[model samples]
Target: MTSRPRTLIAVLVLVGITVSLQQTFVIPLLPHLPTLLHTTPANASWAVTATLIAGAVSIPIVGRLADLWGKRRILLACLAFLIAGSAMTALSASLGWFVAGRALQGIAAGVVSLGISLLRDHLAPHRLASATSVMSTSLGVGASLGIPLSAFLAQYADWRLLFWTAGGLAALAGVLVLLVVPGRSRPPGGRFDPLGALMFSSALVCLFLAVSKGGTWGWTGGVTLGLFAGAAALLVLFGAWELRTAQPLIDLRVSRRPQVLLTNAASLVFGFSMLISSLVFTQLLQMPTAAGYGFSESMFVAGLLQAPGGVCMIAMSPVSAMITVRFGPRAALMAGASVVVCGYGFAALLHTELWQLLVCSALVGSGIGLAYGAMPSLIMSAVPVNQTAAANSLNNLCRSLGTTTASAVTGLLLATMSTTVSGHVVPSRTAFTTVLLTAASAALLALVIAAFIPRRRPATTAGPLLATPTAVQRHEPRPTP
Candidate 1:
C-alpha cells in the first residue's frame, strides 16, 4: 500500500533511457554507413554486432563489480562510458573508430541490471514487484521509442546528431543516478573475480560471434564451428572455476535454487519468443504495399505502429504488481506466460489481417509486461542481496541469449523458406507458423517451470521486511521492494 520514493523511479527511468539509447541509436543508421563512411555492409554490420557482443560479455563482469563496490557508482561509471563512446562515435570519420566507440558503449550495458538490483535495494515491499516489472519492460519501451526517433534523425538530420543526442542523454542519466540513487553497502572484502570474468567473457564473445555471424559464416563452417567449440569449452571451465573459488564470481549453488533457475530459464525462452513477433511483424509491415497483408509504411510509420506496445507494457506494470501480490510471483509469472502463449496462438491463427496483428501484439506486450515484472521478484526472493546485481545480470544475459538465438533461427528459416502469393514474394506462411508454434511452446514451457517455484508461507502486511528475506537479506534486511 505504501508508495516508493519518486527519486528511485527517476533513477530507473534514466537507466532505461541510457541503456536503450545505446542499442537503438545505431539501427536506423545501419545501411547508411556504406555510403556515409565508405565502408562495406559487412564491416558496418560489426557496428551493430560489436555492441551486442560487448553487452553480453560485460554485463556479468560489470554486475559483479557493482556488487563489490556500489551499484550507484557503477551505474554512473557506465553512463560516463556511454557518453564518451557516443562522443567518439560522433567524431569518428573512419569505420574502425566508430566501431571502437560502439564497443565502449557496449561495455556499459550493465545499467539495466544495476537498475533492477537497486530497485530491490530502495523500493517499498508492496511496490517492489510492480516497479521491477516496469523496469524490465523498459527494454522493450526503449527499443520501440528509439527506433522511430533514430530513423527520423538519420533520415533528415545529420547522422552525427544521433550520437550527440545520445551523448546528452547519457550525461543526463549519469547526473540523475548520482543525484538520486542511494549508496550501496560495502561488500565484505571480496575481490573482483578476474579469472572468472575472463573465462565467461571469452565464452560469451565466442558464442555470440558464432550466432551473430552464423548466417553469413555457414553454421557448420570453420569460423562458426571454432567459435562454438571454444565457447563451450571455456564455459565448462568457467563453471568449474566458480565451483572451486572461495568467492566465486557467481554462486552456482544459489543459482540452482528453483526460484532462481526457473525464472531465468523462463526469461530466456520468453525473451526469444517475444522477439519473433517483433521481427516477423516488422518484416510483414514493411513489405511493399503491393504485397497483401503489408502496409508498406515509411520508417516513421512502421516504428509508430510498434511503439504502442511499449506504452502498453508500461501501463501494465501496476496491474502486474497487483497480480504478483495477490497470487505470488510464480502464479503471476505462469499467468503472464500463459497469456503470451495465447498471444502467439492468436498470431498464428490471425496473420491475414492488420487488426489481427495489432491484437496479437497487445496480447504479447501485456503478457511480457507481467513476465518482466515477476522475474526480479522471483530472483530476489531466493538469492542473497549482495548478489542481486550479478544475479539479475545473469537473468538479463539469458534473455539476451534467447533473443539472439531467436533472431538467428528466424533469419535462417526466413532465408530458406519462401512463397509467391499472387505473384508477390513473401515469407513462407508455413515457416512463419512454425516460428509462432515455437514461441507458444516456449511460453508453455515457462508456465510448466513456474509450477515448481517454492512457496513462501503467508506473512502479515505490517512489517517493513518481506515475509522472509533471502539469504543475504537475512543478515541486514536489505531493502526489498
Candidate 2:
C-alpha cells in the first residue's frame, strides 16, 4: 500500500477508536455519579441515557451532512463536539452540565460511520477492503480497551480524568486529520432539508426515549405508549416528506433496494448479538459468586477478562477482509454470523468455567469483527458513491436500533427473572442463560438474513479509488491456476 492510504487508514481508525471510547467508559462511574453529581440515582442515570438519545439523533444527520457538505469538514465538526463535550463533562460538578456534556459526546459516535464513507472516497479497491474492516472493528477495539482503562481510572484516579483523557485523544485526532487527511471537494448536491431533519430527529428521540427508559419508567405506562405512538406518527410524516422532497435526508427509494434493506436488517440482528457480551458477560463476571454463576470479581478484573475479546476483534479484521475478497461480502457476513452463533451456543451450555466464557467472548468478538467489516462493503457496493456516508450512517442507525433493543430486552429479562442472594435480588441463572440463548438466536437470524443479500456485484465505479488505469489493473484479482 502507498503511504497516503496507510496514513489515512491509521488516522481514520484512530478517530473511530476515539469516538467509541465513550461507549462503555462511563459504566464504572455510573453508580458513583449520584453522590458525585449530587443527584438521585434515577436522575444520575440520565448521564447515560442522554448519550444514547443524542447518538441516535446525531448519527444519521451527520452522515447526511457529510454527504452534502464534505466528509472531512463534518468530521472536524464531530471531533470538535467530542473535545468540547469531554472537557465539559470533565469539569462539571452538577448533573445538568454532566448530561449535556455526555450528549455532545454521544454526537461524536457518528465519527465511525463517517470514517467509513471517507475511506471509500479515497484508497484503492483492494486496499479499501482491509482498511474498511480495520476501521469498522476499531469501535470494538476502543470499547474493549476503554472498559478496563476506565475501570482502573475509576478505581484509583479521579473520575474526571476519564473525560480529560478522551478529550486529549480527540484533540490529537483532529490535529492529525488537519495535517494528513486530504480534503474532498463538496460535490454538487441538493439543498439540506431542514424540515426533514427536524421531523426525523423528533421521531428518533421519541422512539429511542421510549425504548431506553421504558424499563425504568414502566413498560405499560402512558408516557411510554405515548412516545411510541408519537414516533410512529412522525415517521409516517417524515417518509412522505422525504418522498416529496427533491433531495431527501435519507433516500427512501435506494433504501428499499433488497441489497441495502437486507444488509441493514442483518446489521440490526448482528448488533443485537454483539451487545449481549457487554450486557450479560460483564454482570456475570462481577456479580457475587454466591449467586451460583457469578465470579465475584471487581469491575477492573471483569474488564480485564473482556479486553482480550477486543484484541480478538482487531486480530480478525484482516481475516474478515480476506473472506470478503475471496468469496464476496455476503459469504463473509454469513461466515461471521455463524461463528457468533457458535460462540453464544457455547456460552449457553458452559457457565461454570471462566476460561470457557473468555474463549466464548473472544469468539463472539471475532465474529463481530468479520460481520461488521462486511456491512460497509456491502452497503457501499449497492449505493451511489455520493450517498456512501448517508447509507452507511443509516445502516449504523439500524445497528444502534438493534443495540438499543437488545439493552431493553435483556434488561427486561434480567429484571423479570431474578433470585435473591443474601437478601439482594440478582438475575437468576436461568435468566442469564436465556439472555445468552437469545443472543445466539439473534446471530442465527443474522446468518439467515445474510444468506439473502444478493452477491456483491463487481465494482462499477471505483470513484476516487482508482488513481490510474495502471493502479486499477495492479489491484485486480489474479486468476487461480
Candidate 3:
C-alpha cells in the first residue's frame, strides 16, 4: 500500500472507532441518568433508545445519500453530527436535550459502512481485504474499550466529561480526515427516494421500539403488539413499493442475489451470537457470589476482563484478511462462526471461574473479528462499486436487527428464569446456560448459511461481474474463492 492510502485507512479507522465508542459510552451511566437528569427511569432509558433508533434509521439513508452525493461529503456530515451531538450531550442539563443529543450522535453510526465503501473506491484490489478487515474490527475494539473508559470516567470524573472527550476525539477525526483523505468520486445521480426512505424508517422505528421496550411495556400489551403489527404491515408495503420503484432506496432485486441474501442471513445470526456473550457474561460477572454462578467483580473489573477480547479482535483482523485472500470470504466466515460456537459452548460448560469467562469472551471476540471482517468482503464482491455503501449499510442494519433480537430474547429469559439470592431475584444458572446454548445454536446456523454462499471467481481470473440494475462493474477481480 502507498503512504497516502495508509494514511487514508488510518483516518477512516479512527472515525469508525469514534462513532462506535459513542454507541456504548453512555451504557455505564444509564443507571444514574434518572437521578442526574431529574427524570424517571423509564424516561431516562430513552437516552439509550434514542441513539439506537436514530442509528437504525440513519444507516441506509446515509448510505444512499453517500452514493447520491459523495462519500467524503457524507462522512464529514456524519462527523459533524457526532461532534455536535457530543457537545449537546455534554452541555445539556435536561432529559429531553440529552435524548435529542443522543439521537444526533446516532446519525454517525453509518460511518463504518461508509468507510468500507470508501476503501473499496480508493484502495488497490489486493489491499481492500486487509483495510476493510481492520475497519470492521474497529467496531469491536471501540465497543470493548468504550465500556471501561466510560465506567472509569463515570466513577472518577464528572460524567459529562465523557461526552466532552467524545467530542474532542470526533473533532480530531474530522481534522485528520480533512487533511489526509482524498476528494470524493462523482456520485451517481438520482432523485432522492423520499417515499422509500419514509416507509423503511417508519417500519424500522416501530420494529425497534417494540423490541427495545417489549419487556418493559409487557410484550402482550396493546402498545407492544400494535407496534409489531404495524411494523410488519409497513414492511410488506415498503417491499412492494421498493420492487416497483425506478430508483429504489434498497434494490431488493440486488439484495435477493443468493450470495447477498445468504450472507445477510448469516450476519443476523452472527450479530445475535456476538451480543449473547456480552449480555450474559456481564451479568454473570457482577452477580453476588451467593448466587452460586456469580464472580462478584466490580463493573470496572468486568470491563477490564473483557478488554482482552477487543485486543484479540484487533489481532485477528490481519489473520482474517489473510484467510480471505487465500481461501475466500465464505470460508473465513464459516470458520469464524464455528469458532463462535465453540466459544459459547465453552462458556456454557465452564463459566464458574473469572478466567474461564475471560477466555470465553476472548474466543467469542476472535470469532466476531473474523466473521465481521469477511462480511463486507462478501457484500462488496457481489455489489456494484457505486452501490457499495448502500449494500454494506444493509448488512450492518441486519446485524443491528440481530443484536436487537438477542437483547429482547435474552432479557425475557433472564427476567422469567430467576432464583432468589439474599432477597434479591437473580437469573439462575440455568438461564445463563440456556442463553449460551441458544447463542451456540445461532452460530451453528450461521455456519450453515455461510456454507451455502456461492464461491466467487479468484482475483486472478477475469470474468464478468455479477449483474445488477445499475450494472456497475467491479474494476478488479473478486476476492479469492
As for model 2, its CA RMSD to the true structure in angstroms is: 5.3
Which TM-score value belongs to model 1? 0.91
Per-residue C-alpha lDDT of model 3 across residues 1-481, encoded as one tens digit per residue: 2358988999999999999998879977887999999999989989878988999999999999989898888999999999999999999999989999999999999999999988877887778889999998888788888888888898789999999999999999999988987765466766678999999999999999999899899999999999999999999999999888777799887788788999999998898888887678778888999888898987777667778878888988988998888888888898889999999999999999888998888899899899999999888777777678999999989988888789889989998999999999999999999999999999999999999998883332422222332334643223221
Off by over 4 Å in 1: 1-4, 184-188, 419-426, 457-481
Give me the runs in candidate 3 sitting further than 4 Å from their true place.
1-3, 457-481
Ranking by TM-score: 3, 2, 1
Error of 3 at 218 (Å): 1.6
lDDT of 1 by residue, 37-100 (tens): 8888888988988888989988898888888888888888888888899999999999999999
Predictions in order: lDDT? 0.79, 0.87, 0.87
Positional deviation of residue 81's Cα in model 3 after best superposition, in angstroms: 0.8
Q: List, residue by residue over 1-481, the lDDT tens digit for candidate 2.
A: 2358989999999999999888788988988999999999889878878998999999889999998889999999999999999999999989999999999999998898999988877877778889989999987788888888999999989999999999999999999999988886555455788899999999999999999889989989999999999999999999999888877899887788788899999999898888888778888998898877899999888877888889889988999888888887788889899999999999999977899889898899999899988888888776776678998999988988888899889999999999999999999999989999999999999999889887744444443222233333343333222
